[model samples]
Target: MEAIATQDRITSKAERLRILEQTLIGAGDKGVRPSEIARRLGVRRQTVYRDLRALSNAHVPLWNPGRGRWAVLQDQYVGTVRLTIHEAVALFFAARLLVRMADEFNPHAVSALEKLSLRFPEPVRTQARQAARQMEGSPRNREFVQALESLTLGWIERRKVRVLYRSAEGRAAHPYVLHPYFLEPIAPGLAAYVLGYEETYFRSIVTLKIERMTGARLLDERFEEPANFDPAAVLQNAWGIMGSPDPVTVRLRFTPDVTRRVKESHWHPSQHIEDTPDGGCILTLRVGHTLELVPWIRSWGRSCEVLEPAPLREQLGAEYRAAAALYHAG
Candidate 1:
């Protein structure tokens, strides 16, 4: 197939740079001719020669190996960035994380890394790439990625969106109209959620999981972000992603078995720990209603107990009874 018209392909300065880098790196020892570079760039051969000369003058390691052919020396690039080992390792892992979470790994990130590695100091690049591979995980399905991209566009354009979503309860998918405002990243996924106004429920701000959105489309209508909307303030006391509008002060007592572990980690922004007699500890948190905390408390089993909030305690009792009944039935 004929290559895309170079003018159509190189739409931006960044694209031109990427193409030049790719061509130079691909032409290892054989060295590419100026005419070939001109054909690829949709420019005249003279223009290519001028650019090459300018690059050489700028101390870019471009050299003519032989026979009117030009090539970039291996591991030598113009304006190559030098990153500390720690910085390189961090970026490598971050790229791997984005790749793992994206349906198709971001092409720009992959391309940038490839370009950087071409000039990175020998063994460090190899080591960082290896470590990154070990950090990679499976990406989401294609449809989920598409939905996420659509939602992101809506958020950026200040447009409303309609979404077909499947809940964690395994119920049939339902449609929702939302005014997407922000995207927040949660655990188990590298992608963030679309936090927005649920139009069906007026004045309610809800968090929508992008992965659960089976379908999404942006509406023509635009929205004004709420003047009082402050994401940080809204989520200041949240235990997890979703929290109650009216938070409660919760007190829980943990037995000595897990106090050390519990104290070592900062569970929430409002969490406070007080040492109790008999080597136990009391954990206090001013947080949203206790719906999301149930699983966390239950995970501790008999070692933990909710000391306050009668309603939450009652809910837990009911859940335990339901569990007992299910086990007894078998």
Candidate 2:
């Protein structure tokens, strides 16, 4: 019982500190009264005052007017980095996953996100929290991550590194000079992924999962990339970050029941939405043949219709038919 009470006290203290920081940070140099803090945090005014006192004792750079209001100390407020709604949400979740991927990725990113709780408007913060929950994060591969960091660092420094890699086809293990062009984070575990080409294999951008790197060895070979090497444009036509030279314009129609809900959120940057007279909504996306969009499209079940893109529609139609055949067979 005593230990439980102590734990509760610690939890309460942390909660109060969070309330205190959020109250002051969002105040924007304006002072906040205890009543306001209590109202926002759903606590008593006295509790708010107590939390304020605790914050002051912690040297949080807060000052009380002595009349029962606390304001952040002048010249002590470090302005937070301003972020748009999508940017904050994306950054928060991405940073969180990155930190979890490589243990040494960035310890301070979580702290920064914690600070951003106060930085964002309440609605944006809430929405971002919800958005963060929607991501599909893979398990952290720590051993794979460490090897990636070592090799990527060596590669960027113009040092050649031999990497033992397993291809996606699971055919054979090969050693080649890995040039890490970009880091892609698939899930919560890997900090970021390294993309480069292999000297022993195809010169195309081979994606090396940061968490799957088995071994890395640094070599003494240095060569500068082409002057017009534009990393951003490298995968211009790629679908869902996996760029390919060929892209298709895929069109989909959502059933009346699902159209409104679908319209409430932005599915893709290249999305175009049109409402049908009867009620259904048409969504078209210009993307590569990368299969990333399949899961989202499949989630709607019979409610979604693939319209303009014959290939996508055929693919989905085949899958649905196959599933139906299985049911009938069973």
Candidate 3:
């Protein structure tokens, strides 16, 4: 009971300090009064004065300029970085998107923002708080979240992990020995992929969907992450997630209807678009394989045509034939 009471005292002291810092840091030139701090913290005004005196004695850079105003002096605030309301809001949203990926509300992140919001003045403070409450996060699988957390620990500690993963076809689960290196969050934060060294795949790196990872445990063994390991450099060779290190040159022709959309944002790092004589444009890319690119190619229907890379063209033809068979059969 004594230990519990002592812990409570420590927690209360920390909260008081946080409140004091937040109030002073955001107080600007007008400064804050003991009454305001006391009222906000539900403490007596004498307690606020005593706390301020203690803080000043501890070299906390608090100043009691003339009058009853207490302010955080500018000279003592030089070293630390301060975030503006806009930056704080942006960070809040970005963190919100990742919260779903973690499969739980991140209390630490929320608390940090809450403390930072204390530094925001007037309408901006209210706005930041409201935005934080209203922002929506993506849906994440609990099992996948657990796996990701464990794998992240292994990645940070440079330890190996055993993952029970199920393939897309819903096959039986298989245990994979992995040396986790990096996590890649897909654009718009829809999903994430984990890239690492799989013991079964020699001399090459492998990728796994975080959602497919049912279980992950850190092993006692440790491994060194390659100094030159870069996810972008490795992914640059392909259209989507996983691809070979070697880049392949691929070209395609797109009709005028969707030419602008195709040219607006780069589909691949190596993409180059050229206007054709007809009302169309030719797109070129140096990628690793056409397997992932096949589905996207088919999405364009007749608007897109594979030009270079004869194998991709043949594969597209086969896809078209199979698709046609499906429609004809029905």
Candidate 4:
């Protein structure tokens, strides 16, 4: 009976410690008082203090913020990760790429990079630490952070989210109740987008940029993801994050000068390249929407020409002509 009782006490203590850790983590930088922690966990102040000490001894990075408040140094706490030298080198390079890609501050990214750097040796470690510091210096976007958090919660818990979104067109903010299906990071890494089923407004699956979300709230209403809904399948033909139900085939003729540059990388899964008679190349690919391809097509300048889908060709022609007129007027 004594042994059983001892086991019970051990189990209870372990559970309490787990909950206590979560409570402290959720408290964030402001932290919680010992008295508040005791109240929340239905424990004595002495017990909370004892657990805090145990956690601190276990290297949980708990810190006192005066007024008897306790908080975890969130950024300093990274659970153990074991990596081989090759794996670590790969991660180091990926970290650098992420740092370059990030246009806005993300505390989580900074913390992750800092943690990863600790596992490395010498110069590589120093470089990784510097990369993290650089990211830390970037300006924080509170709205984007909040929206990302809310959408992340919705996606993880299969909950609906209420969002106020403003489009790129600078239109009035519109409200949406979305069932977040996926969170996707778009190219150049400057923006993130949430693909979801809009219960309000669109009444269909739509992609909304996270930066454009002014406000977001996680709803109590939960949802079951459709059995047939496959994110990869949905984005199979996507040029970027936005994909259409119907796809279109696009072909572009690249001049010899840029043909080698274009052929250096695989741009799309559906791409088919053929050498032209004039030492140029004809690149053909299927994409869900021409809209996402416009900027990419324009970036190649006079080195490329859109040969198929007359509508897109005409659109680019009109835009080019308008730009020419502006330059001519100037």
Q: Estimate each model's TM-score.
A: 0.62, 0.57, 0.62, 0.75
Q: Can you tell me which runs of candidate 3 are displaced by over 4 Å? A: 1-82, 85-140, 188-190, 200-204, 324-330
Cα-based RMSD of the predictions, in order? 11.7, 12.9, 11.8, 9.8
Local lDDT at 188 for model 1: 37
Best by TM-score: 4
- Among these predicted structures, which one has the highest lDDT? 4
Candidate 4 lDDT, 1-330, residue by residue in tens: 999999999999988988888888888888899899899889999999899998888779998877778899886675456788888999998898888878889887888788889899878899999999999888889988888989888998899999899888967999999999999987543679998899878988888899999779999999988888999998999999767678999999999999899999999999999999999999999999888899999999989899999999999999999999999996
Native-to-model Cα distance after best TM-score fit, residue 248 in candidate 4, in Å: 1.2
The alpha-carbon lDDT assigned to residue 171 of candidate 4 equals: 79
Q: Summarize candidate 3's per-residue lDDT along 160-268 as a digit string, tens digits.
A: 8888888889779888888999877764224568888988544457888877887678799998888999877788776667668677788999999999889888788
Displacement of the residue 73 alpha carbon in candidate 1, Å: 30
When summed lDDT is taken over every stretch of 10 residues in candidate 1, the lowest stretch is 131-140
The local lDDT score (0 to 100) that residue 116 gets in candidate 1 is 55
Model 1: per-residue Cα lDDT at residue 56: 66
Off by over 4 Å in 1: 1-84, 88-140, 166-174, 188-192, 200-204, 318-330
lDDT of 2 by residue, 1-330 (tens): 999999998998787787678768777555788887788888888877788778777667887755666788655545335688777667766645544454442323434554565556676666444433332233444556457656656656755567776765777777667765555554423234666766667766566655445777667776565567565675554445565556778878888988779899976667789999879988887776637678778888999877867777788899999999999996
Model 2 bad stretches (over 4 Å)? 1-142, 187-192, 328-330
